[model samples]
Target: MTKIFEMPLYPYTRTADQDAAAPVRHTAMIVGAGPVGLAAAIDLAEQGVPVVVLDDNDRVSFGSRAICFAKRQLEILDRLGCGQPMVDKGVVWNLGKVFFGDRRVYDFNLLPEEGHHRPAFINLQQYHLEDRLVARVRDLQRQGAEIELRGGNRVQAVDDLGDRVRLGIDTPEGPYTVETDWLIACDGAGSPIRSMLDLDFVGRVFEDNFLIADVVMEAEFPTERWFWFDPPFNPGQSALLHKQPDGVWRIDLQLGWDIDKEEEKTPERVIPRLRQMLGDEVAFELEWVSIYTFQCRRMERFRHNRVIFAGDSAHQVSPFGARGANSGIQDADNLAWKLGLVIQGRAPEGLLDSYDAERIAAADENILNSTRSTDFITPKSEISRLFRDAVLDLSEHYDFARPLVNSGRLSLPSVYDGSPLNADDALEGGPARTRPGAPCPDAPAGEGYLLDRLGGAFTILTLDAEAPERVSEAGIDAARVALSAGDDPTGALAERYLGAARSAIYLIRPDQHVAGRWPAYDEARIRAAIRRATGQE
Candidate 1:
């Protein structure tokens, strides 16, 4: 029998600072300990920045939420030292099948081409993920990462004073006031900080609701995503099936807005629907259940002076794409390096503004894709349904129409094209896959991967070339590595980074995004690009 996993609750201990005569200030304060806030804390602590993380709860998430972990999100988690465990414990699947009215319309594979480090996606319960992250923070704490997690502590007020932000925290022991150079709000969709400031979360709220249930059962279902538009068992609505770790299955049933939300969650009402989809012979135990409405919305900006918003606190999307947690992790990835640099005084505070512009663009992309997926899944009008059916029908035989079929376009990493931080590359003929402003494509580097070798600081990657004798110091931790033909035996690195016998040098940012690349190494250009990437130029 496969055993279910549960995380032990972290104890809420009163800190000396809470018992002090006056409120204690922290260098960085993070609100919430969900995946997003925890990611921020872990990333900052890994960079040796002291972080104080406050969470209103003392236990991991109760449900098997946010099951799909994208490859890019895994990479980000890998940097924080928790990705491998997730991959080890998760159910890895990249194939997805779409069906329409008992007819299989289309199927897709996420990782068609290879040489990447992580799989395209993994299915792990949100609780399990949070548990692993909490354990990782403990490990980092042992390593002298000054990170303090105060569970049962909630933020009641936030004041964005120039140069610093003040937070009024309410703890089980008592209430305390503290100030920080930066305050990152990773509280959920209902962000109290957002509410305190009266910031507008602008976007559309679709009139469709989805019922998600996690069931424990021994079944022969393949470990792949199966999506249905008007399934035969449950007509006029969509259904989704995904295999999660620990013999659990996540089922999503599209319930129109008019349905009674409370009554639908009861097992008496939900079991019959499950029996209709699965046979009565299949015995199962209910694990967790939730009903949620779709909303694709975001704040006007992610950053406000000394206070920054990340994760669901900044934007929200429908669950169809699995963009919420994945994008939230990316938000932490984008912010951590910039915040670390600013805190170290190596980069100007304007570097933090670039994080806002870039992540806001990512949020916009997520919202757009989620909105489109919602529209296709639950058409609002007869004409919309007609077009959706037509597209689904045509997708059965045609490849072009398959792209039109939106049963939730699975999450992918957003590229920061035309970002102010991206330096204009002089070399246009190199590999188009690793273009300027694109996340550095991972390739086989010595024993591990390119991303593992290049993150956490500015790195200059030279292919088929030697480092220039004279390198300029732009006041950032910069390292240079040259890969000779012998070092790259597979030629995969050259193919992904340098194309067609081309030799080049790439300036990779701390976040592992390409700042700029040149056909040949130029010391001055490299320094200038680094300065520009850091917002110093």
Candidate 2:
């Protein structure tokens, strides 16, 4: 079935902040109650913004939507005060093993990162994380902030008139209308939001399809991922094996282009193939199996007008690197605080436009990196397949060849370099090369209060030995400061982060990346940036 959409952009500020009073009397409406929408609503409510969140489903169910949460995603979840609980529930994995034809090809360990003590990655099902987030968001309601969750409510139409977004929702009660200052869509890959906007979701769809099955297996496959190359039963095809919680395992079997989708993917046929692809006597109980034909498309723009797109509504990557929902949540993290700032009369309207600039950069980078991963995983050309086999076959003997043989790429954080909203001197070379305003190094200070204790909105880390009152005088949130050097820049803190990075004040955005850094407190620049980042100026 084909979908058609039409979005109208009424005149609004294109490159400037509008003078306003009382924030134009706004409420926010969010479409889709998934992680991305929930995260966005949670961030907004915490900032004292009134929000109405709608979803077609009323409750949570465990399904395979997203599987991995990178370090960055965890940090954003921490802002909502739920990441620690998530960490407690899921196992942190710093080690990953790659195998080809029953032989180990490559292994990676990620503990050597500058600031983080925990592993860089965690393996938890998406719905489990969603379950945790929903609880955290509810906890905010006790403090007089509320998220009106309209379960079983589907957004049918959106009219983005410049000043307000008019929404038509179909609900169990009946059709209703919602008027909001902004509308955020988190409606997944086949987003009704995107379809209603008439925007092109442009990208190449992969010809090769894969059968994904979540099952319970008696075989004790190690926790690390296993990759098989050209198994005897499925010659010239590969499969992936990874374990999940509750003794379940996720298996991905490559489907040939010519194979009949329904006949070959049935439960009866999948078992024999599983036994052949994964050895006999495995005694694996099949749970759920589905065929996924992936595409590498991205929407032309994240925001068309009053309606803003997030998660699968913004972009869809070939699920090779597990960057889909995780990236979407980050987009919410970035956009929420800015929206709150604008709605609360803290920032100017121009700040909202930056949401488009920053997230588009994020989406573009995700697509490029995920595209590379897709190419590496599904070797399309004959030459690429031969080379992949050669590398895997040779990895055992050659010490230097091990890293080269790995099919996976180290997931690099998307950088916001070219964004006009980024500070001109934010990184400017030297030791701060992880993008202009990347997350600062995490260091442990033993007095029961560490850097980990300072998450929730933008964090201003004061590194000045003197405890300067400059930031406070400039009307910045000084109590929001995490005093890095209380008495002196102690060894405990210095050794954890790079020594030279001490004595610098870091202005971290709500997404936890450094928005700007200064050698000492500069009242004028920081105040301007705070206003800019929050849309206050």
Candidate 3:
């Protein structure tokens, strides 16, 4: 039998409430110490905002939950100061193969070309990611970043005033109430705070179940995602295989709604099923098993008065596309900068509304993709299954039907197309890939990557033309480069940013979203764009 992972318990500490102390007020308080909450604390502290994080549990997650981390999420982690270690400890891959019955239908590469720093996807356990973020938070605390992480503490009640929030926290010693200018809830889907406020999570719940098992074995399988529909061993069912760190393999088997959940997870039942797929003689040990039913749901709004919601508390999606945790990290990234500015009184309160707008749009997009993937994988009616099998059969021969296959569209950064913060499309005949409302694409910049040079605050990217001295006088960060015609070294930055002939200038937000772009540097227009991006206009 494979040894189960043993997590150390975090000791509960005495708080000021146990003693006769006055109520301590904070600039911001974050509830839940999951990946999203830890990330939010780090981002806010890095921006010079004092933060306090509280969680009921002390250690990281227990199992290999939420393993697939996308490149965009890795970039966000890098900005928070812990991406490199996660990448070093993760299994990186870009290729996936889909099989129809016994024959290979098609194979595709996510990132065919590689001039970037991070890979398309990395398979690291969610616990490892949370540990790294927690460590980063501690490191920042030693460096004078005012971040206090209190474990074994849960928020029993929350009272939201017009301009501040009051949290009644329960600890081992006693209960105490503290006030904060703002409250961020990173609790999971069954959030008590959401329930206390009587907020309803609205969406569709699929009636299908999927069994996931982690096995420790020495196998010769390549580092690629292998998926099968109606394999010989498990007829009329779908199976997925993925490689993870530390000689572990994740196998997901589709189970219909009629099966008993508890009986299916037993080793006696699971080992036989695995043996049917892998040869009977192959040696392996079952590490963990879980049964899950897919759901695509989200709250109507993320922001509620002085209290805000993030991560699973705000939205949720099926695991098919690996969108749940990745999108949650993006949500924290989007809200941190805006919340920091609001706490510092640098912007108006209306700025918080934009977070609600953009993240709701992103949640809708994720839910739509996840629902489509679940439907294709677990078809409801006979007509749906017929069409799915037809597409898979034709994909083996015809290239046209290959795109019709829906085996988890895979997570990609969403573009906020209708964001009120973006400038109107002004420049014609330039690179539309990095257009307004899109995340800044990574490109070779000097010895590093483009995204590495463009975060933490507002920046202006000027390429191929001389930046006027008056540009900096406008009080905005500018990365100016005047490249010669034949001096195209990496040959990617200019092409991706489309700054070939004349000067191309782009105003970037703190979260690295492109606010506006112009062909020439205009100090007046750039400042105006900055105001619009920050909700100051």
Among these predictions, the greatest lDDT belongs to: 1
lDDT tens digits by residue: candidate 3, 1-537: 432235533446886644647667889999888889999999999999999888888888777878899999999998989999999999999999999899999999989865678999999888778878888988998999999888888889888778788888888777988888999999988998898888979998999998899888989999998999988878888999999988889999888889899999999889999999898878999878999989999999999998899999999888888898999999999999998888887778898999999999999999999999999999999999999999999999999999989889899998888898998555666677788999988887776778887767877776764555334423344444443323437677777777444557777888888889888777688778877787877
**Candidate order (TM-score):** 1, 3, 2
lDDT of 1 by residue, 1-537 (tens): 432244335657888877667767789999888999999999999888999998888878888889999999998888788999999999999899999999988889999977789999999999889989999999988988899888878889888889788888888778888888899999989999999988979999999888999999999999999999999778999999999988899999998899888999999988888988998999998998889999999999999998899999999999998999999999999999999989988888899999888999999999999999999999999999999999999999999999899999889888899899888777767777688878887778878787888767778888877676335565775678777545556777878887765688888887788899988877788888888998998
Inter-residue clash pairs, candidate 3 = none
lDDT of 2 by residue, 1-537 (tens): 311101111111111111232223348888887889989999998888888777776665345556667777776787687888878876567777676665666666655554354458776766677778777766887777867666667778877788898777676555656668888888888898787777768887878888888777766566665666665666677777767766667888888677778976688889988888767867778766778876788887787767888988888887767778778887898889778877777667677788888888778888777777667677889898787777777876787777655454545556676655545354222255433455554555545434465566555666543434434322336344545544323454544322465466656666666666666666677677665555444
Model 1 misses residue 157 by how many Å? 1.7
What TM-score quantifies how close candidate 2 is to the native fold?
0.87
Give the top-scoring candidate (TM-score): 1
In the order shown, the candidates' Cα RMSDs to the true structure are 1.8, 7.4, 2.2
For model 3, state the Cα shift of residue 351 in Å.
Answer: 0.6
Off by over 4 Å in 2: 1-26, 113-117, 399-406, 410-412, 424-430, 433-435, 447-451, 467-502, 535-537
- Residue 519, candidate 2: alpha-carbon lDDT: 60
Worst 10 residues of 1 by lDDT: 1-10
Clash-forming residue pairs, model 2: 5-198, 346-536, 347-535, 347-536, 348-535, 348-536, 437-514
Q: Give the residue spans of candidate 3 off by over 4 A.
A: 1-5, 17-20, 468-488, 499-501
**lDDT for each of the candidates?**
0.88, 0.68, 0.85
